[model samples]
Target chain A: MLNIGGLNQGVVIDHIKAGGAMKIYEYLNLEKQDCSVAIIKNAKSSKMGKKDIIKIEGPITVDLDMLGVLDPDLTLDIIEDGKITAKRNPRLPAQVTGIIRCKNPRCITSTEQELPHRFRLTNKEKGLYRCIYCEQAYKR
Target chain B: MKHVISPLDLSMEELDKVLSLAESILQDPEKYSECCHGKKLATLFYEPSTRTRLSFEAAMLNLGGSVLGFSSADSSSAAKGESVADTIRVVSSYADICAMRHPKEGAPYVASIHSGIPVINAGDGGHNHPTQTLTDLFTIKTLKGRLDHLTIGFCGDLKFGRTVHSLINAMVRYPGSRFILISPDELRIPTYLREEVLEAGNIPYQESKVLEDVMPKLDILYMTRVQKERFFNEEDYIRLKDSFILDAAKMQCAGKDMLVLHPLPRVNEIATEVDDDPRAVYFRQAQLGVYVRMALIMTLLGISAG
Candidate 1:
């Protein structure tokens, strides 16, 4: 059994798809933060069979919606006074701005550095986001 | 108010309006001559397209609008490595509307984002050609007198033919529009189109390798060239190059009133002998390209069809 201390006042990101925590970690730039952060990779989970979790030791604003874009299975727990005060499961956003880059080489966003990489949720059932300018579908 | 970057951009209602305007223009060309008189159209073509460029120029001139911009990237600032965004930014200032054709898939879309004026995608690699789709819609509505309840046959190069894909995307919106997609096995329509566009919409469609077998049932026979340039493998190109040729013998099986249309500049895919056939309207289809473009340009410029 792996033992870790509870966060006094911070966020605990849970239920990440196995092996997806590092990407989310890199995306959030959590490594550069001044507070203590621990990443539990390949943690045993009854629901997911295997999952990853991240515990941040101090209160810091994170764009949870971006985590949803990266991995919709992720759940966030806001800890206060050593208690899980708020639990949140981020839904796929309707519109995401300047997060995931359009992968299509021909997409205008590739050449135009000044343009924001904007995508709109086109197919909710399939979790598809299409680039606003190029209309290239990105499946999550 | 709208930039036509793809066929999907136009709603069914908007498509009908453009088609009707095209018909009215076709009937009395003199009435709509001065509709775009004071307007300027910028044709920013990054690739060499004789027919599309000339047709656009003719359409603007016929509507009494002047055209500006280069015929090729070599002649334009694009040769100097100017991005599509910068080119459009500069051109939009001088022109009321711009029509751009590029080798890249979403070049016009990028231009549309940056330009102050409306941007029309003339052709974008294998991705889209909304104006060509508009021309096809106009041709179908004029010849068939209806947009619905028609069995349209798409023959040859279904996989890479952007015109075929665009036309199918537009026509499937109309009620009772069935598609008979005929192509060689190697050149069959892409699975995305089959599953997403046809199957997802619940639009009835049938695929076959033999064009003759499907000819009698078709109200419209749209032939496309098997573009050698699109194929990376020379052997595959040679094998499928003459797969679905539209000769007079093939036309014998087609309906007398069945309209045969092609986005022109044909090679050997369509035999020259078939050109004399009354059903052969590919030339007229090319001519309708002008009217459709005129309608599109006027509509994009907010000029009422008076």
Candidate 2:
């Protein structure tokens, strides 16, 4: 068993479903940023069938709201000086500016490449967003 | 007020106001010229309903407004990962008003929340097509001389026919109007509609499998496409499709003054031979789309469409 050394400062996104770790990485844009990140896939977990954990060493800005979109069940633990300090289940944003594509095949956003496909937060209580052009809703 | 998101949101007075304005525009086309001059109407169609989109653009142009926007999400930044709220916020800044057609159930309702300008829903998935309802209302009022006390038969794909649903919703408001629903057993009107709308309204209605049998009793026959897609079996489609097609032979059984209505893009649902009939009102119905939308735009903008 390989043990991850205590991080001086960073976040550990744990209990992510094993296969869904890549999605989490893409959601956080982890590959593009300057940080030491380790993605451990197929780790043993009593609570989850097969869990994947993301260890980000050094402070890296992560949009937790988007992370919520990828995996709402993810739990984030911010580590500082090798001790768990802050824990958060970041609420998904009610309105996301640019994330999901409008599924309407005939929406203006479908034809005009220059135009932005917009959606509004409809039921924030349920983390729902609807397309501005087509009226499609997404629950995060 | 910048959009026609749903029919129920429009009060009877508001609906009548638009209809009356449409009548004025029809009476004097030139009087309404430049109603949207130097402005633009953006049609953001996320689905393929060329007929509806063209009607909207034509309405805007006839009122002296230019048109912009795309017909699908695939051709826009939406494919590149933009959101609907951002799209409308940006489009609203550019266009005076927008007509949107989407494949989702409540897309326009979502758009209207963040949109600065009016956002009319051309069609939203299988949910609603309110503008078509307005057009139907306008046509019935114009041709039949009244929307009240008429026997309107909604024939064919009532299950998925947004137009039929919307028209039925609009007509149920008036007194003395009854519905004769004609469709195959497989494609009957949905139960929620029957329960929540028809039965709740306590409107008199009859259901039958034959069109000709009910023809003589109808003041208006609204025909909808019998979608081949709705059937799971080829045999069932072949069995029920011909039952709904409105043919010249069927017209002989109809009243002399009875109007035949269709939300256009007809696919042999009404035989071409029947188009020559004076009572065939589908083309007239299609033309009314412009007038009704003209009225709708001006009403939403608080301008006199006339």
Candidate 3:
């Protein structure tokens, strides 16, 4: 077992698909964070066989739902007083704004810089998202 | 009170209201002629579509409203590098309502977000054309006497036909509306539509390469042009260009009451000889575009017939 220190108070993002921790790290903009963040890539797990995990030491605000979009099977654990306080599994959000950009070149967001790229989850089972403005489906 | 960005934006009840108002306008044109008196319609067409622009202008004029704005992007401030949001912010102040046709897919959506007045999407790339859908629905109801329980056949260029996609989305909301999709394999309907729309709605549909085979089963045969501009390869366009031509012989297989429709400026997909057929209703469909726009303008402006 690889030993890593437990966080005094922070969040631990677990069960990220192996090798996906770097993307989640970049997506969360952790590089610029003033606090400490440890990224573990391809850690052994009995359930997943191999997985990536991100641990942040200190209170921080992160959109878990976005992490769900990046990796639906991810689990989040909140640490308080060096003990696991809450365990949460992020589910697919019904609506997402400014997270995923509309890829359609003709989408108004491509030209109009002020509009936020918004999408609505039209099908949960298929993981389908449609642009709010153009209704163009996001290719999975 | 809302801008029409897609056919799905309007609920079935709201669609019925628009169609009912259109029917009333058809029966008593004079009663609604001056309903929009002293109002203004700004037509901000970023692309050249003579028929769509003219229909909107004529519709507003018939309702006693004045028309303003340019015919193409080169003539408008868009050519001066003004963004759609900024242009619409300025235009909405001058006009009571706005109708925009842009080559970019969601340009009208951006305009609607920034404008104060109701924005109507005349057409937008291969993405959406809500007014055309309204025109089609109005024509369907007018000719078939109902919008439900009809076997609608869509032929040619289903892959890029925004009108066909919008119409199918609208029709599936009604019960007993089956679709007969006829097109070359290269031009079949997109997979998202097949899955999200037909399959999700559990709407019964059949795909076929032969148009004549499905003609007899159709209550309405909607033909679309095989748009050359939509093709990436010229050879592919040339290969499938004549895949489904509705000639007089093909029409012989259709029912006497079957209505034939096309979103026009066609390129040989529909034979000229079919125009003389009693079942041909594309011309009447084009004319209905004007009345439907009138109804839409009135409804959007909250104007009621006298």
Winner by DockQ: 3
- Model 3 misplaced regions, further than 4 Å: A1-9, A42-51, A81-83, B228-239
Which has the better TM-score: candidate 1, or candidate 3?
3
The C-alpha local distance difference test score for the whole of candidate 1 amounts to 0.87
Ranking by DockQ: 3, 1, 2
Q: For residues B151-171, could you state the per-residue lDDT of candidate 1 as single tens digits?
A: 999998888888998899889
lDDT of each: 0.87, 0.83, 0.89
Q: What share of the true interface contacts does each candidate keep?
A: 0.55, 0.14, 0.86
lDDT of 3 at A20: 90
TM-score winner: 3
Provide the lDDT at A37 for model 1.
90
List the candidate 2 regions with Cα displacement exceeding 4 Å: A1-140
Q: What is the DockQ of candidate 3?
A: 0.69
Task: State which candidate, 2 or 3, has the greater TM-score.
Answer: 3
Q: Sorted by TM-score, highest first, which candidate order results? A: 3, 1, 2
Tell me each candidate's RMSD, in Å, in order. Answer: 2.7, 8.1, 2.4
lDDT of 2 at B278: 99
Report the error of model 1 at residue A122, Å. Answer: 0.7
